[model samples]
Target: MKKTINSLKIPVVFLLLVSAFIACDKDYSVIESDVLGDENSDFTTGDSLWSVTAYNKKLDSLQINNLGTTSISATAGNLLGVFNDPSYGLTTASIVSQLVPSTFSPEFDENPVVDSVVLNIPYYNTVVSYDEDNNPEYRLDSLFGDNDTPIKLTIYRSNYFLRDFDPNNPENVSQKYYSNGSSTENSALNGTSVIKFDDHIDNISNPIYSNAAFKPSNLATITTVGDGDDEVATKSGPALRKLLDNDYWKSVIIDKEGDPVLSSQSNFKNYFRGLYFKAEANTNDGSMLLLNIAATAANITMYYTSGADGSRTQETYVMNFSGNILNTFVNDYSIPLYDGDKILGDNELHLKGTEGSMAVVEIFSGKVDCDGDGILDLDAIDCFKQNYRQLDDNGDYVKDPITNRYKLKKLINEAQLVLTELDNLPTGSVEDYHTYDRIYAYDIKGNSTTLDYSIDPTTNTSDPLNSKIISLGQRNDTGVFKIRLTQHLNNILFTDSIAENTPTTIGLVLSNNVNYTDNAEILDSGDTVTTVPRASILSPRGTIIYGSTQNTDPKKRLQLKIFSSEAKD
Candidate 1:
């Protein structure tokens, strides 16, 4: 946004802006201009492309979770599917701020309006500086500090970027970079030149405490309070406000409607870091826990390399997590950071060339310590279990299995038995998984020369085909199951090799020829033994047959038949 005061060139010069609207004829639509200074036009008629109050109001509309509620719905199950029920934790406002869409318009323009814009969002920080002796001194009220506490310096790093899109190219649309390298000027739009916001502080009653003061480099400036604003101390604590001059905190002003004042050294377009809010030891308290919440925004900076065709393109790194800070601290407080004190979160941004041209990739690789307990969230076993469920094979809920490998293996073995039918077979019970009954036909063999089962038999009336019919009662349920004693083999007997011996137990002597005496007798001998297989009525249903290769004889085959009982109703 740029502004300049110049001499009036023409008395009747008419400034016209073409806007899209429905035509009165209904058949055609076109861009038409309404006179800017027309007498009948409403004062608020023109589009408000760049307005600060409206923008600030929009920022204020972002929500936060408060501790005051009695009962709450699970945020993960309710809001955005992020937090789960038992793990009802959220990020601090700083972390949540990252979720704010980079391309959103606050102004309610009926039609799309394009305008260069600027906005300033405030933040608090704990400033540390060096004294003349090279010893570390602390400032608590610079742009990063709190004034009401014993802190001396407070400061903030403001993020700046373009808000509107370029009408010329679609790919160069409303994408926000940073204001680190821009040559834009820093001034205020309204004449008041001052903006104040709330920054919380802790007194002596708080858990943490500190009192220090120091200065900063030219990157920021501080303003003093004047005699007229003595009433500002009403809330700033009795001795707290008097420790510094009137302009203890600097007021950052960026002139939007004028030429850019930021020099190229600033690199506004590439400044992708986050605003870290450091606290003085005096104001430390439990505020560090506040930073651990997921509501806090994890800052991300996207890097890109422009393509040779004068268009933009993404690189091979589809995306990555840069780093995340709890936005809060815990346990101890000092002017500077320590090695083990900082808790970093995964928050790399997604960078892509043309490969990611389709849809944005959702890469999750960040951690949040919403409670600020010094322990990483992932390492907290209870916290992890509360937030995530154990998924079964069907993607349904199930109890979390024991972590011991042996215990898990046993449980898996038991689970597989539920899918088998051995429990319902003969002499079978649920607990009888290890039991087996008497073995029958343990050493059975098939006919060596034929695929079908056949037995050698008597040469005369007792046919080999009839002797081969060894009935084994099989309960089959496929279609209709009926038992039939049939000749299983095609041949009756061979010519010269075999014959039947005289039978001993004679029942009836009947012959076709009266002169000849021929009768068949039941024979009970060591070589001939028989057992009639039993069969009971089986209500018809479906059946499944399992055919397996004989384990004893590799070439032998066996089949199992299963039947479904008919419903008793």
Candidate 2:
């Protein structure tokens, strides 16, 4: 055996040397290694699946005052009417706006007789076609709920004075008003008595105007001026044109022409206060309209004939809806309760517009075993330090001495927050009427856009509807929303203290326009949410989406998927 081993060693050595020469000479160009070597590899790419905690948060009240000199075009249209959503319940929208005389003082001719007073508020419409007589046909836009259904609309004289400056603040800060009429928080801040619904002038007994069944019409309004051959017909787009009681206008405006009440804008505002467009549900489901109350064409025109009997000429006195215009809302929906553990998130997210609910999304929530089952909850998976921390010889995370936290070093290529709509939503006439096409995401703590939104190159300033469309992947055909958070995620990962800035919760709500990023202050009991997206306040639609705690179908649950690469050690 010893001799055989010694003899075999020489043969084995000689054979290996011959085989090595043969292999070197043979063509092996097609053979490739699957593994990317450390020297050759710049980074190792993989997807980091992170759990998202999403839950519905109820909005108590939203700031609805269009403050200062802000034009109506710059903001969402004044919502007026009632909409009974099958999912969100009843929403009554009303407007209380100050009226300003076109001129401070008026010098009327002799025998000024008030004829007719008309209030004109234009509707958002598009010219569909024109008839042979050059009369245009219109289609109403921005109308929610059943357009055929009617809402009880009443226009009243508001007795409460909306101030320009806060009376309580010595610094002369602007006054802030909320959507709820019962909210006394703003009044408490200004040291003034709250203006309740019953405080309006002639609201019940003698409103300025009342419509038991008010439904919007898409037909153009045509009026004939003059008589016989001298008559000229003027046509305008669809509008809510109502003739007010002539005697009322005469007593309030025409009769007070030379009085001190009509001497200046401030004087007129104080004397008249404002007009309130109060909306109530005439039926279980009524119509809602986005009104252009501040449009140039929208005004109260008082037609009066002046001068002698022989030279009686029809003159006009115009009053504009100006100054502190406020939109009040009455939401009669059940508030979503957070009964489950917040760390595990909620089952469904309720996102409604106006004074409705919004979803709060937390990214990279730490591990939590809520059920005490010796296993981490799937919804509470921690993907922060566990994925990015450096491992030592014992495979334990290497911690920094100064911060006392695991060191994280990873390059985030892309991070997307995926939201899936609930597929089994109730399907019916009211339920399927209007579905929101877009949803906006913002930093709740900062009350501003994320870095990704700011850096998105597709932001079209000219067209707000198209702004950030790519980054904010709107609801696709499959009913899914994928919002890019690449820059936002990178910022958190690269921050000096990951634990301090790790959980950046985001707010998700339906937006009328994403480009309208201006935030309106929220009046609530706590200081948790100070403001919300103003675009959301303008919309009346709502939707339901899957949250994180839906365990049956994990794929439908909200998640943050990050395409990342490991940094060089």
Candidate 3:
């Protein structure tokens, strides 16, 4: 934000702001102060003059990983029958999860009777509203496909093991899959892969990750559970139920009684591997469903009668998916992006899905030469970084070097960040993410070796300072999310008592926050890592918003507005 002086005015009025800094409401007191009398008194009862500076810049793509969560989003935006997102294109996601071994081997009764071998995957439900019948309507959390709609889904045995991680590749050492542009040739993935990508045909050369023709499968039916006798009003929701193939289950688990692989977790993981759940739209114009395979009640139960012949009681061999970090189950998005013809010409930005473009916004993405170089290139130009001429109490420019820098001494009352969508955006049926309660400002600085700010290396999901993302809603006429960046901006503006400097660059994903936060998966160490999911469950359907780079209207572009006050020192 550039501040200009009024040169025309002869007698400049320098109003003295002398309010008690300790009194609450902070810097806002200046705007509503009603003190009269001496305009030059140092102890006047008035609000401080809180100045606002709007900083806007086009975001550059930064390297991010450890997002860990994969998403399955198939949407067709049809209000009538089945809804599909035709504008952005339809995409079905698949997942392959590694099963942690059973605690102990159980002996079956003589002539064991097989009742049923069923796989139950619970749907994501957050209790929100109730229906007319007083039936509890569940709000699906990580679900993005058409609600109350049907889509074809299948489960398969993965021929290849997920070579995403190993003991050689630790958490500190990030893998190539985490970053979009990391070195793939030397990705530390030792073993060969059996899963093939059929993207390139007879002539095409590039191997696509989304192509899943190489894997073998069995179909799983998606149906609503608790509809019949198992009706528990509170926990009633949809599920993907599949009867296990008798021969396959027996060979993998039942018949392998004395096998050493079944005795150990690591050996069994290498021998049998995991199951892949694949969802498909069938046609280009069908609906999609978002089912949470990592939910609490989702598992495969091997039903068998272990009781004596006359007694006959049922027993189960449960195959629970204990989300191991090394397993690396993820969503592979193969959807089309919002490629407006105009954007190609001007290189303009358009924020969309995970498969689409992401906006890289910064507090001050603009560059400046802090070392007094003739040209500006590296350092960011902002109120915190930029050096200015010292100002006196009379509001006149004072020649001082030591006290010239801006000091964030007072309490940071608040800072509002408003990101607006372009008027000439890609048109289509976009989910008001507010309704689904899915939008977040992710600190995507997972694999960055060098950043201007000091980020905690402990967790990659959230920044140490700013963790929660709360949407302020569409405040103005244009569709914009008014995000409160008080804590985020405060850290940037003020120097932490411990660390002398800030991060060089920080990443923020304006995507779904829940996908990165709400997780029911536990690691091998028995630690619950809910900070970030192994994959995102955000639907491929999305919205296109404008960046600060667009100059059509200054008021409609992305900008960071900081309202700060100076303490009465």
Best-performing candidate as measured by lDDT? 2
Q: Which structure among the candidates has the greatest TM-score? A: 2
Candidate 3: global Cα-lDDT? 0.39
Clashing pairs in 2: none
| TM-score of candidate 2 to 2 decimals | 0.80
Give me the displacement of residue 421 in model 3, in angstroms.
1.1
- Give TM-scores for every candidate, taking all chains together and pairing residue i with residue i: 0.16, 0.80, 0.60
Q: Is candidate 1 or candidate 3 better by lDDT?
A: 3
User: What's the C-alpha lDDT at position 407 in model 2?
Assistant: 50
- Tell me the alpha-carbon RMSD of every candidate: 42.5, 12.1, 11.0
**Better by TM-score, candidate 2 or 1:** 2
Q: How close to the true structure is residue 424 of candidate 2, measured as C-alpha lDDT?
A: 59
Order by lDDT, highest first: 2, 3, 1
**lDDT tens digits, residue span 122-174, model 2:** 99887889899877889887788787788888888888888988877889898
lDDT of each: 0.18, 0.72, 0.39
Runs in model 2 deviating more than 4 A are: 1-44, 67-75, 129-135, 181-193, 334-341, 368-410, 430-435, 460-466, 495-503, 550-552, 565-569
